[model samples]
Target: MSHAEIEIERRDRVTHGDYIAKLDTSDSTAKLSWTDRQGVRHAEHTFVPPEARGKGVAEALVKALVADARQEGFKIAPDCSYVERYFDRHKDLSDLRA
Candidate 1:
């Protein structure tokens, strides 16, 4: 399905240090962020429900996180395996890696 077909809902809770992108269905994707002693944002975790698998939901989440990192002038530590593999696939985003 196209990205348009999959509506991603965003919830930014800075107080909790979490940025989430969720689908209309029960399936949702989320990225957890934390700041280091050096004052850098780290993308610590990404979660995609089983039903949302193979639908590019996780990629979309990572892309959103990357975009935020770029706009906010922070680097990503991609602690999640999914985000790590995503970085491997998208070399262009290497500049955002921390």
Candidate 2:
């Protein structure tokens, strides 16, 4: 898909008492949430549905969240496997890590 056609957005939804990064596609959806407490932000879990796998959807959501964190002046502590790998692969965003 072209960059313009890709729709990446974050939903500020609370699930089980945690902030979640929900990726909403045309038909499917995925989610990632941070283990944040007491002004400390920690990347906790990323949940991609079986149907949404292998579509680059998760990457987009994570990238958007990274940007959001940087823009908001917050640091990220990625505990999610997918998020950890994303940081490992994208060294450019390492500057935003805590």
The TM-scores, one per candidate, come to 0.75, 0.72
Lowest-sum lDDT 10-residue window in model 2: 14-23
Model 1: which ten-residue window has the lowest total lDDT?
28-37
The number of the candidate with the highest TM-score is 1
Per-residue lDDT over 1-98 for candidate 1, one digit per residue giving the tens place of the 0 to 100 score? 45556544555545336655566667445444444435456667777677767877677777777777788887878777888889999999989888
**Which TM-score value belongs to model 2?**
0.72
**lDDT for predicted candidate 2 compared with the true structure:** 0.65
lDDT of 1 at 67: 78
Query: For this target, which candidate reaches the highest lDDT against the unseen true structure?
Result: 1
Clashing residue pairs in all predictions, respectively, total 0, 0
